[model samples]
Target: MAALALRGFGRRCLLARLGPGPALHQTIPMATTAQEEMRRFWERNSRSGRPVSPHVSIYKWSLPMAMSISHRGTGVALSLGVSLFSVAALLLPESFPHYLAQVRALSLGPALLCSAKFLLALPLCYHSWNGVRHLAWDLGKGLRLPQVTQSGLLVLALTLLSSAALAAL
Candidate 1:
């Protein structure tokens, strides 16, 4: 029935598909240029101070949601950090030990050294922890909302502790 009705669209018989509605010969308005029509629509919406789509502000924050986004961010940061470090290692005239000696020569305080170590360890630790969380998810575990929240908190805690432990070294 639908196929026959669709075929009717190519003829005036489309009016019959409307089920006793107005005749097909009636005139209806159409935008000749879709671009101009869309531009006008956006312009009108802008003037009316109405949002055309949902904004980030409309979304309510949740623990798992935040952790998930941070997991991806840390993964990107770790990859970029390692790649840039490798490229710099290849291009630099000095070797790794030379750079270590240069840093030691700076005589930066232990507090500063620890802070720098923490900065280097932070993304790695977070990424590693979150990766394990992701692995668990793949194994069909910790998928419930409560378990996700608990695991997210656990990942954060472990990241902090492990990063500190690494920095201490």
Candidate 2:
């Protein structure tokens, strides 16, 4: 009786290992099919002689276009500046004044130092004012072409004015 029960258990285990019914471990060749399809697509597109999309080199420069790009760039710069300042605040052994003192001790020329400070402040000011302008547009203000041009000019003027003020300090 014991031998018979052992044999039955062994058969059941073998069947379980074989998996339910005849749907055994199947190898799908979908990857090769996808590659072939992609190859065909490229071939078709190539044969049709349709021009590919133009890259950035194709676009002409305009004031509005330049301002739009600068807005994005300044935003990224400000975010990175804040992140670096936060990291320095946490990692530096001494307080903020200590670092300032050390920098002062370097005796860097005032003009050069002020220029660097101006460069940093300029982007921040530009991005901030432009961001406000963007928000105003979002609220359905200044959407007209004339208003856009005027607001863009305002953003530039404010950026330069504020940057100069900060540098003077």
Candidate 2, residues 1-169: lDDT per residue as tens digits? 9999999999999988887754555645565687889899899988997656555456677677899999888888888989999999999899999999999999999999999899989998898899899999999999988998899899999999999999989
- Which stretches of candidate 2 lie above 4 Å from their native place? 1-51
Worst 10 residues of 2 by lDDT: 22-31
Clashing pairs in 1: none
By how many angstroms RMSD does model 2 differ from the true structure? 7.0
lDDT of each: 0.88, 0.89
Clashes of each: 0, 0
Q: Residue-wise lDDT of candidate 1 within 1-169, one digit each (tens)? A: 9988777775565455566555545668784689998889999999998766665556688998788889889888878988999999999998999999999999999999999999999899998999999999999999999999999999999999999999999
Off by over 4 Å in 1: 1-51
